[model samples]
Target: MSAAQIATGEIAVGQLDLEYVVAARLTLVAHAHARGARLTVNGHVAVNDAAIRVGRVHGITRDRRGFHVHAVAMINVIEMAPERAVLDAGNTILGNTIQSNGQSGVAVCCAGVTNNLVRQNSISGNGAAGIDLVGSNGVYGVTANDPCDTDTGGNDLQNFPVLNYAFDVGGGVIVNGSLNSHANTSYRLEFFASDVCSGSGYGQGKTFLGSANVTTDGSCNANFQTLLNSPVASGQFVTATATDPNNNTSEFSACAPVIAFRLLSIKRQENDVHLMWTTLAGKTNIVQRAFSPGGSFADIGPMIILGGTGQITATYIDIGGATATNYYYRMRLGP
Candidate 1:
């Protein structure tokens, strides 16, 4: 059955498995199609084999990935935590401290939520993603799942607040927007730093991918419309194309006609900070220095937190220096 067709929340009340869920491959949806699905469980489930699997695909003909282990089962019983229901389907997980168990937190695919107003939920301990925004766009987004479950949940409500990011994020947050935003539209993705994420991947790459007049913060950057028709840097060859998961030339990873260098500052925290950042296809190499207005930077070894594979992530800890002193910093990129 399709994920969108079988998103059932018919739990066995107090019983772990009042029935049996046997399928070589299972599709995960928001809730198959149940209303008011709140997750709240504490215990163990008996999948026998692959009782509860995460990340769904129609079926892969090639050898399955190690992340996809094999098991045997008949009466697979899963018990979830209290007040925790699977977040709709198609996940684009972009939060902190997420843990994947059998069946407890969520069972997402690609494309998680957007512009979530999270506060302080421990996002790293869930069975699936603490908070994901995966979608059916497939290679169109981040991961791959059965597009069949596209009708899992509604995309209106914002999500939980995760301060840390120590778990796994198939689709790390994409900052600096991308190379293909319209003149009037703004694409923003924000995150709350914490012990889990520890300020992972901060200002690691481009905030504004296009070449033109715009504004940029350490966390975000904007691009102008005309910049899309300009020339690149002298001898600086960055392969440009209108390709992406969705082939939307005006998308985050889409290649604009040109690009320009811009700076983005980091969000200041009262305590020790954990930083993170992402690099799409066409963006200037990130140059992060600690000392302000021209000072030395902290050495982070070779590779300077690169984003070669299209998406790069980095983590750093601030010892917290005096207010008047110039902190250390550094930068790197495709240029």
Candidate 2:
């Protein structure tokens, strides 16, 4: 097409699917300048163009709640300016492989760009973050997570999920993390895996694993654990994002590497305790003990085991293990 296909004015477009749309300027522009103007673009491949643009433009009324861009691929650079593959959302950007763009893969720009759900997408190889939420300070990239997520800008400056650990079991991956956000709110958490973290140090969703829904407590805290059936091997990295009840999505969390170690079993025989764990080859394991769940854990001495080349089960025995009133044991991959 000589000019970009434009969707404007007050109308409801059901589905706009573009295959091989190429242009020097914008390929598809969905501007919600008129009230009740709704659009959904899906199964598209836009290269050598500004690709797909969405939001309120032209100093007019905003669009309604039906704008969505999903299941598309927007790679290749046209470098007109620092333009994102998709921008300025009060909508959803879901299940899109947006990579190597001139700017961010997807960005929610400026104030009042709320309820933009960015989920289930492999967003990487961009110049900026995979999902960039403009901070209240008018800066780009990941805004530091504030207490209770009170700060506001793009997507209300939504706080991303901080992962405690990601472990690759034999069958699947177990991911554990927590989200601190608006009180008594339900949020959607999406997990992704990457071979390496993005340059920005926040992260990029290289491979979408799975998603879970969590509701925060009165203290604005939600602890979640999910088992992802996707094929994520040990040594790969995992990341996650949080989308609030308003569909406002946050940036990718800092990458957490998938660990190959797991504390399998613990048994007590009289005053002795036996511990068994799955360990990676040529890796060192450390055992720690604590009295309470929230208490400090100290390393148990003279019990470290060095693993072999194959995945093997290692065992350690603690003499006089019943000396303490209560005991908790944990193992970690050591040096």
For all candidates in order, the CA lDDT equals 0.28, 0.68
Q: How many angstroms is residue 305 displaced in model 1 relative to the true structure, after the best TM-score fit?
A: 13
lDDT of 2 by residue, 1-335 (tens): 22233323222334444444332233332333313322322212223333344322221122231123332223322222235644455665655566766567776666777788887777777787788888656676767898899987888889999987677877788887899999999998999998877765678878989899999999999998888898798878899999987889998998887776677889889998999887655556788889998889998876465644545678888889877799998876553
CA lDDT for candidate 2: 0.68
Candidate 1 lDDT score relative to the true structure: 0.28
- Model 1: per-residue Cα lDDT over 119-197, one tens digit each: 2122333333333333444222112122211232123121111111111112122112222222233333222222221
Clashes of each: 75, 0
